[model samples]
Target: MNKNKSEHTKDDNYLKHVSQIDQVNFLNFRRYLIDWYETVKRDLPWRKNQDPYKVWVSEIMLQQTQVDTVIPYFDRFIKQFPTPAALANAEEDQVLKAWEGLGYYSRARNLHAAVKEVAASYGGQVPVDKEELKSLKGIGPYTLGAIMSIAYNQPEPAVDGNVMRVLSRVFIIEEDIKKVKTRHIFEALVRRLIDQKRPSDFNQGLMELGALICKPTKPLCEECPLQSICLAHQQKIETTLPVKSKAKKQKKLNYYVAVIESPEGKILIEKRPSEGLLANLYQFPMIEQTKTDCSLLSEYLSAEYDTNLNQEQMLEPVKHVFSHLIWSIDAVKFMAQASFIPKEHQRWVDKKELGDLAFPVPHQKVLRQI
Candidate 1:
């Protein structure tokens, strides 16, 4: 209908500009980008090989996490669960423990589940076909595309936030990048622009360009490979081209954490439920409440832990930000002598034993005080 025609016209306009690049310039474009990538690409451990498992692990870890933070975690993760079979065979607690400090516990859980599927069905080999890869838990389009291009060298577009920003500036696509539909448009554009022979390098180059040159603020236009052909640069609007709406504000809540020490010098910690936030991780006794009064802590301890306690000391409130929520914790220290046997998910551990248990970052902070 009329809407289809309008969409067709818009695509035609964009391709018309693409068609304007002469064969020599097009060659130079690819050459400059790949050449720059070869010389300046970061010496990341994942880039050392075309191993699909390593690339898959790196891609999952890199989501919503920075490279500097992921490197050590990645090393330890691979060392523990080196293969699909290894991860699949490992216990859920082991997987979550490895992923303790790296927020987004669901990613680790889903990854563990998916790898189990791979072991069961695919014989520990990560699937290369897009549909099969998509069948795994937590493997979305962006992740599938990343595995396809980087690991299999397929001509698929790994259009993440970095790729979106780079392409938006280069082609001057003014649509709001936050819209889901915008992602499909950019994916198609990347499908056309991606180097067929070296799709891996091409996609990585775009990511690097966005991360380094075509930054969200203070873009280095002069050094960009596509500066000569960039529509945003020509229009002097590189900074404003990739428009994105602000994210929804995270819900804020106050939590009261109790650091209860036993007479035997062991600390009491509770395990989160098998589902929901911080699932299966260890944390000190905590209750979410609006008020910061210590009276609530005393009542909670007596009711739940079956030990009467007074807040002997109060520490500075800890501020922890999850993607969808913010936790301001008011932690207090208490000492108790009890004969009660530990619950199934609760235990008392000394400093040496605490080292082996997986404590989430928030509880890790409280542990330092004890």
Candidate 2:
């Protein structure tokens, strides 16, 4: 299903039940959700203030990524690109490098592209309205709703997985959660429930409820404040409220790197092809294999760099994990020749300059020794 562009869809008949919702009960649930939020919410830095830039960055990074994984990356990225203008004006390669290991390189690329336009056209201020926000690259319905409600105090609903799960259970929605129709139906329900007085707190509070209390597995139902109103909770069907298909397993790869170095302090690194995994990133010259060793590593480079690589110069094996692939790399060091040719795709840099350049995760690890 090509769910690439999700317009602010309005399914009137689908959400007819929402118009008749009991406001008093919804407000009680809202208060309970917010009360739970104040004490139990995760101590994320972005939540500390009401900056659109910070909230936008956090939302962008948190897409399809775990909260714990994004926390450190978010901290580091905000330290580097503190504002919309900072990120908007920065180099794309630098942004992607900073976004390394987070996966989904396109998010970083599209974000950079969109903000460049924002800086030029919108004076670098993130747009407040959902329509304006949607015009930017990579900013979809959820992102727009998030920025609108959380950053700008708009009374819109951000229907993410967590919120969907919680809402589906509260009203006992039985439709397939994977379908866009199901989510839109729920969003209309929450949109009217949003306390126009405190939309930010209300929306984030529901998100908070789902994340901490009504989790996907082994929900702390005892701690949930919406126990009285949640139909799933009363019926003991909370786990099955938001039904969806199983996730597809990511394919795995066993990649190896040959980190070769020369005697005079220069190191051999190659730029990855301009497409596919880790595209446009730097890596140590590599030898692809199902399995490998020092002997194979030496022979692989015989014609390319030099066979003068000493066995003692070789560092121990190193490994890195991407979502699908497992990369295993062995570092091999060499004594330099007086004059060696650099290939079109390869570069020989002063080893000390590795830090200055953006090496991918695996190459960055090999740099500690080589």
Candidate 3:
């Protein structure tokens, strides 16, 4: 593409970290990273497979989720679904059940949708090209890059938070990583340095480097291969490399989460609206945070339904943390003599079956305590 001066300048903006990185330096970093990865990379199950579907699933699941947490789920999910056709054939409820307690239910929902599309459109094979993969819903640039390189051996770059953190620190980038410009810049840097032949190794190497060596907290500088040329280490500010805007404050709200039980041992649960947070998951009947007593809960239940809340014994309050909110929940367990009624949003599930349906993570924590 031919470019005018202005266009060239705009494109040049993508190399803000070049002052600290060049062919020699990045190659050095890459060598060290690949070496460290060959030796120290954790034996993740997904790493053992080249199936694009499994790779995509693992990548999506690992988003903002811990490796320890994802390991078991990955194992079970592969066992349950095995292939794109199987996942696509399953019902939404079954898929959600498989993805229970993973917290971000949308990933599973989107995976289901994408699978159906792939089955119908691509003969159930996940596309290998970055552009084709990106065309699928919920597959963004980072995910597409991951899918391409990790599963297809394409030299595409996946500039996730971990990659961004690792690169920004390696090259002493000062731009706020939260910005779109930063993503473009860092992605370009990754593309420049990525080993064309062994891209899967390159992308995973970046992630592993960030996770273990270039951590946000006290980074292990001595053990790092880039130590000699690291500007952050020399500045004694390795802890503060990769500067970015502060995190948005999490919204705080009070909730009265009901663990209401009937005399028949049926627990009152509800299905959250299938649009927002954990939309397709099961949950306890809850009220927005407000000042409430036993009378308040009793009165509220009586006003809303056919089966009334009978007795009141509230459980200890639990605080549930989300990416953008903190729910201070009061688990109110009520013993009511109510039969099944199709209310606006409540379902009385049996105690036995409740274990199968995946409730949101924090709700499970409350269930464990109460």
Best by lDDT: 1
Q: Which stretches of candidate 1 lie over 4 Å from their true place?
A: 1-28, 341-344
Error of 3 at 110 (Å): 1.1
Tens digits of per-residue lDDT for model 3, 1-370: 5545654465477776467765247667678778878988898899886788889999889988999999999999999999999998999999898888787789889989988999999999998655567889889889899989989999888998888887777677888888898888887788778988789999998888788888888788888867876777777877786878988999998888777777788887888898998896888887875656655787687666656776567677788788899888878777776665746777777888888887887788777865
The whole-model lDDT of each prediction reads 0.83, 0.77, 0.82
> Pairs clashing in candidate 3?
254-289
Clashing pairs in 2: 263-336
Q: Name the weakest run of 10 consecutive residues (lDDT summed) in model 2.
A: 1-10
For model 1, residues 147-262, the per-residue Cα lDDT tens digits are 99999999887989899898777667777889987887777677667789999999899889888898888999998988887877888988886889988999998888888777
Off by over 4 Å in 3: 2-11, 306-308
How accurate locally is residue 164 in candidate 2, as Cα lDDT from 0 to 100?
86
lDDT of 2 by residue, 1-370 (tens): 2332222335455676444345238778768877777777788889888799899888989998988999999999999998878898788778977898787777787788888878988888988756778899998878888889999999877989999888877877777888877778877788667888888988888888778888987888888888878777778888887888765576555445665556666777788787787777788777766545556655556555644554446576787766666676656665544436768998888867777666677777777775
Better of 2 and 3 by lDDT: 3
